[model samples]
Target: MNLNRFCYFLLALAAAGSLFTPHPWVMWLLLVNMLTVVVYGGDKMAARKAWRRVPEITLLMFGLVGGWPGAIAGQQLFRHKTQKQPFKAYFIVSVILNISVLLAIYQLYPFSSFFTS
Candidate 1:
């Protein structure tokens, strides 16, 4: 499958797997964002070396899956994917989508709140 489809399928699988794991959101945010940062750096290196690059959709999908913070960091840190047409707009959409999903989860299952103490 293409990278875009793979990204979605990966997340769908993770989401389903998370059903039985406690506080999966925490794991997703921490791990995915770290992975996102590394991917951004990898993409930057690929660009400099003229090597195969990470797909733009994969980058955006990272944000869509709660990696926006890392995406922002990666952009600034690696100076990658910044000022690219359509990418910026799509990244914003992904961030919005992630936020919407977070809110929906908060309003959903009784134990979904991250702030639960």
Candidate 2:
């Protein structure tokens, strides 16, 4: 299988694990995955000039759906980051969207609202 695809699979598993565990361990796993992808992707993007041709918006969408790390890795491995305009903008927007969702969840539901009182 494609290494990038494999990494993404692992990321998905890790993210889903968080839903069940909701522990620091799971969060750590998620963070590691995300950071790995981001740093690696940045390096890859730096190498390739195809930055303008790729669609970071699609990648960002993946990130929003617990695929950010994979997107990051794909960006690097594919060497798709050099054009600084759209990629950066879309990346930021993706991050903001994720953060907003997190904040909304925290503020709207301090505890388990899906369960009993």
Candidate 3:
């Protein structure tokens, strides 16, 4: 199988495994972050090789949900997509939006029912 397909398959496998775990939400976030890092690295490699690149929307969506930390780490580690136009702004916005939503959810529901279930 190709690298892209392999990466997605692993991500899907992680999600499926997380569903049966006691801490599914935590597991999902960890998986997402790790996947985000890998994806960033893959994109960097693709750029260098002149291969098809990962979509910008996919990267932004990953950060928008729960992978901002990994996104930051990937940026520093891979030195990829760090100085692009508008994309940088979009990534920052996604991080802020994700944190804002999480904070809002926490304030509204301290126990986080999603975590319990």
Candidate 4:
């Protein structure tokens, strides 16, 4: 298979694996990531069709909400938003901010709290 398809396949496998995990947030993240991928694909198609495109802010919001993995994968698979200067810069910032927030949360809360009620 091609590299893009391979990447998507890997992501799908990871998503499937998350189903058995005890952490509810893992499932949430997987769902959000899948949604992000769909949004990115839709935006790419819209751009090709000369239709109204998804806003950069919306894309960034998805990434900020823990969809960066899918966003990056979408960028590669769809060849979307990888070249725009402002969007690229903001996308990187969003990913960094998201990771930082996740790290902070992990540091502040015990690991069990993330999964336990």
Report per-prediction Cα RMSD to one decimal.
Answer: 3.6, 6.4, 2.4, 7.9
User: lDDT tens digits, residues 81-106, model 3?
Assistant: 89997999999999999999988887
Error of 3 at 71 (Å): 0.6
- How high is each candidate's TM-score? 0.76, 0.51, 0.84, 0.79
| TM-score quality measure for candidate 1 | 0.76
Give the TM-score comparing model 2 with the true structure, all chains together: 0.51
How badly does each model clash, as a count of residue pairs?
A: 0, 2, 0, 0
Better structure of 1 and 3 per lDDT? 3
Of candidate 3, the 10-residue stretch with the lowest lDDT total is: 2-11
**Candidate 1 per-residue C-alpha lDDT over 9-72 given as tens digits, one digit per residue, 9 for 90 to 100:** 7666656765556666666676677767877888899899998777897898788878899999
Give me the runs in candidate 3 sitting further than 4 Å from their true place: 1-13, 112-114
Scored against the true structure, residue 63 in model 3 reaches a CA lDDT of 88
Residue pairs that clash (backbone atoms under 3 angstroms), model 1 = none
lDDT of each: 0.78, 0.57, 0.87, 0.81
After superposition on all CA atoms, how large is the RMSD of candidate 2? Answer: 6.4
Q: Which parts of model 4 are misplaced by more than 4 Å?
A: 1-22
Would you list the rank order by TM-score, best first?
Answer: 3, 4, 1, 2
Q: Name every residue pair that clashes in candidate 3.
A: none
